[model samples]
Structures are given as C-alpha cells and as structure tokens.
Target: MNDSENNLKRFGENLARIKKAKKMSYRKIAANCDLEHSDIKRYVDGKINPTLLSLLDLAKGLGIHPKELLDY
Candidate 1:
C-alpha cells in the first residue's frame, strides 16, 4: 500500500487494538462516541476514514489523546 493507505490501516489496527484491550464492542464504542455501530466497524475494518471531529470523539470515548490514535 502507499504511505497514506498504510497509515490508515495502521490507525485502524491501533483502534482495534485499543478497543479489544478495553473489552468494548462496536455498539458500546459507538454509543460512547455518538456514532453508528456500522461506522465503528467500518473504521476498525479500514473500510472508511475518520474525520477530525470523529477522531476527537473517538479519543474522548476511548480516554486517549487523538495523537495516540494517529501514532501508528
């Protein structure tokens, strides 16, 4: 994959890792982030990219800095 695509995949992997570590399901995280569960699944699956606002919401829900999600 290209660098940008690789970054997206890495970010998705990181998100999944964090989600699994927290023992949270897509529905639960979606509820916390005020997103749809399908959107969360798409994010984890790397089928879609997240917007900055969505990233911020996810970070807040995950109790992490937005940088952490992008660190990959």
Candidate 2:
C-alpha cells in the first residue's frame, strides 16, 4: 500500500484500539458526535476517510484528545 493508505489503515487501527479500550460501542460514540454508527464502522474498517472536523468529533465522542487518533 502507499503511504496514504498505510496511514489511513493505521488510523483505523488506532481508532479501534482506543474505542475498545474505552469500552465504547460504535453507537455510543456516534451518539456523542455528529456521526452515525455505520460511518464509525467504516472508519474502523478503513473503508473511508474522515475530515479534520470529523476527527475532532470522533475525539470528542471518545473523550480523548484529537492527537490520540493520529498517534498511529
């Protein structure tokens, strides 16, 4: 995979890890943000990319810093 693809996959992995660590379900996180559970799922599956605003929303939903999502 290319660098961008690698980064996206790694980001998805990091998101999944943090979500699991916090014991939060996709619905739960989605509810706290402006996203849907399906969208979160796609993100975790590395099937799509989220914008910068979406990143902030995810971080808020997960009760974490936005940088944590990019830690990968």
lDDT of each: 0.85, 0.94
lDDT of 2 by residue, 1-72 (tens): 998888889999999999999999999999999999999999998889989999999999999999999998
Clashes of each: 0, 0
Return the lDDT, model 1, position 30: 75
Per-model TM-score on C-alpha atoms: 0.89, 0.96
Model 2 spans > 4 angstroms off = none
lDDT of 1 by residue, 1-49 (tens): 8877777788889999999988988888877877888987888888889
TM-score for predicted model 2 compared with the true structure: 0.96
Q: Quick one: best TM-score, which candidate?
A: 2
Which number leads on lDDT? Answer: 2
